[model samples]
Target: MGKSPSVGVLHEDDCDEVKFFEKPRKNLQSDDENVDGRPGWLPDGWIMEVYCDDDGTIYRYYICPLSGTTFTTKSEVLDYLFSEMDQCFLESKNHAVGSNLTRTHEWLPKGWLVEIRAGGDNMDKMYKFYVYPPNRVRLFSKDDVLIYIKEMKISGFDTDGQCNTNTQENILAILEFNPEGLPQGWVKEVVFRKTNTGKIRRDRHYTDPIKNYVFHTKRSAALYVETGKVTIRAFVQKTSVHEMYSFEKFTHLHESLWKRLELGGTNQLRTRLSKLRKLSLKEEILSDEQGSTSAEDCNSDNSDTAHGAGQNKVSHLASTTVKRPRGRPPKQGNARK
Candidate 1:
């Protein structure tokens, strides 16, 4: 197999190929495929290369075509690729990896942050790619990165507590990363916002921008030529709102709690709680004292009745005899009533 990670034996017909490989290609099957599951086809843009080592044992390799994945074997690449499960029922259940590589992305309303690195045990070898749905573009040269961010369909990228301007230059700096630009996510909507002409005209808006029309991430710089009036329709998704349960909760609570405490002239939450505790304790003590005084007064009032009344009281008792009917009765003392 070629040193390029895009190595695997797949039938040329089994997997989709790039427009560059228009001719017929060979199908290189791998032994590393699932035992029960049939071997999958090569992915488009990727090619399979096979060569025997000095020891005659056959080894298969799956390589990423856009390059830079450390998967040394076909099995490794298959594991990652099969997550999307390339299958076709019409092809006798033999679903090979075939994707429309040239298809534009159905851009999300927002963007995501993607981590890219060579496939394998390599960790330090990493690249960072950011996707801005506004442009339907990726900032790196890795297929897995593109596939990952698209599949994730993240609503938006994190601001990371830092506010960065989405200026025209900033967008261009990130999107147009040298080499050659790869167009993935498709831009479905493009509405032009005319300058300060009182109100936007209905028929003046445009949906399709010419191919050469440069795309920018910023909405304010919608117009290719800055007439100061905004021409492009750039609607950035609202920044994600921090929920009540988010860390902002603690920050907000901290301020409010401190303010409430400050009104009481105490600056500590613990001190405020302690004051409440003392008030509660004092109330409990007062209630206990009142209950004790009431009990004492009642006891003193009942003392006279309990003492002299005992002497005036008299006791009486009587024993009754029971008669048994004609029957064999027990020889014990007559039944007492």
Candidate 2:
């Protein structure tokens, strides 16, 4: 038996010497979903480098051949790459010694290998690369490829919260962090006005500016963002906001609860909890205050009535027997007389 080929191992047929990928590259047709899942526009031949903030917002710079400088915002580039193509997928980052690399993202595909670049500035600072259809794209580079694939295989990204901008109540729920001292809930929600603009549009309006959410102890939480503000519904549990902000933590919890779920951690758990709160009213039910009533007590009370009825039936039968003897003797005596 032969061992599997190592990372970036190229085959003769797989090599594409073309410096640029032909736009609308022949639709990727394959028998397998993983092979076919990627877009035809994504027929390999791109170099990639991934970076992230301490807070966990990810950025990928690609050496893609495609040309268009109009994309002013990061969201615009991502929207076109991941959402538009459906062929792109993200690569995972390698971990340092004793460092537990956490999978916080739900967007990228599973079982993807991590490959890093050699010392660029610092040996520690290497770009993460994951190649899709490993058998398909040929890696032919000791030299750097100029154009790169910025992002890929995105499942979800946030758009701005659509709160009524005019209202002071601030329909948008804002989540902010105070690293100096943690708040009571370890998170706080306050009403404030924010400017809404065309910079990043999810639909016609609204943008979910990615924000930081951290938990101090598994219990205490923190949220921080440098440029934009996030508005969340007030009373949105600190845990809920915490889950949203800390993608890595959220993914860990998700995997622990339901291992059957796919490679990415579930947003399902968060969605289910949200729907539960929304469906229920704020009013307290009196039954809740009554406290623990056992099934034994209920069964005993119901059994008592049945026991009383059985006793009454026995007494009535006994009286009928006694009366029958007396009535029979009188009837015989009266007939003889």
Candidate 3:
């Protein structure tokens, strides 16, 4: 059996240096009330907080704007963002990515993240981080969209209360925004809006694709042609057709159009409106095509028709000229006076 090696006792001079001499004190101040309406236990640097009245749900939000990544204090959001970034870093980890790449220190709490920049020329481009099963932001998170609706209300832009809540959420994706992300005016050739019950109920409108005119039905589309106004009485029977009005000096590109309407429930009206829109669009296209052809294709045979029936009447008049005097010989009657 090997003899155990003797351990030597060291004096204070022989001991290794200890960098931290005393235990560190903990920060108990973080437990105080948070004015941001978040849980007191959650760490700081949460920029936005959300609540749901339906389920009494609360969501705390943090975002990395450079990567367009949002975190929900859930380990998963953070884990995904870091994993993707780290994977990119493994490929080409260059330190001097860009001078202009900004790092936000004040906005984030300690240990969440340090300054994140594009590591190299290859990675400087945005690494879009998407949240699975996106929450309300997936549908309606833009401030400009909400502001646009409010302005439309102030300007008296009214719609049939058919648009449900889901359709309005879709509309939020369509409302115009300037380059700076401020709401402008309504840009959709047709739009759906929220109603009293906060559910859009029906097909709000039909649109003339050619004129970009909004109306109530396929009949109303042509009604504009008949009366210079589109008064669709699909909902009301006695109201007069009114002229549509719009705001000026707003630039709304067609790129912002919503792909589909999100009907809250009972999509029967939506299906009918879609069929009507297709039929109306085809009719408009046919009319435009036929208008030019009908004018240019006049029959040339009509030019050969003669007007000699007057001469035959003149030949017959001589036989009846034996005192065909008219007006009852007024001069003879006047002699009584």
Tell me the tens digit of each residue's lDDT in model 3 across 188-292. Answer: 222444453457434434332223355555456444432346474533312111111111112222222212322322266567889999999999999988985
Model 3 shows how many backbone clashes? 7
- Deviation of model 1 at 242, angstroms: 9.1
Q: What is the C-alpha RMSD of each candidate to the true structure, in Å?
A: 24.3, 26.9, 28.6
How badly does each model clash, as a count of residue pairs? 15, 22, 7
Model 1, position 116, has a per-residue lDDT of 20
Clashing pairs in 3: 162-201, 162-202, 163-200, 164-199, 164-200, 165-199, 165-200
Q: Between the candidate structures 1 and 2, which one is better when assessed by lDDT? A: 1
Taking all chains together, the TM-score of candidate 2 against the true structure is 0.16
Model with the higher lDDT, candidate 2 or 3: 3
lDDT order of candidates, best first?
A: 1, 3, 2
TM-score of 1: 0.27
Q: Supply candidate 3's per-residue lDDT for 132.
A: 15
lDDT of 3 at 208: 28
lDDT of each: 0.35, 0.32, 0.34
lDDT digits (tens) for residues 118-201 of candidate 2: 112212121223333444321212111112224322322121222112222212223332212322122333222222321221
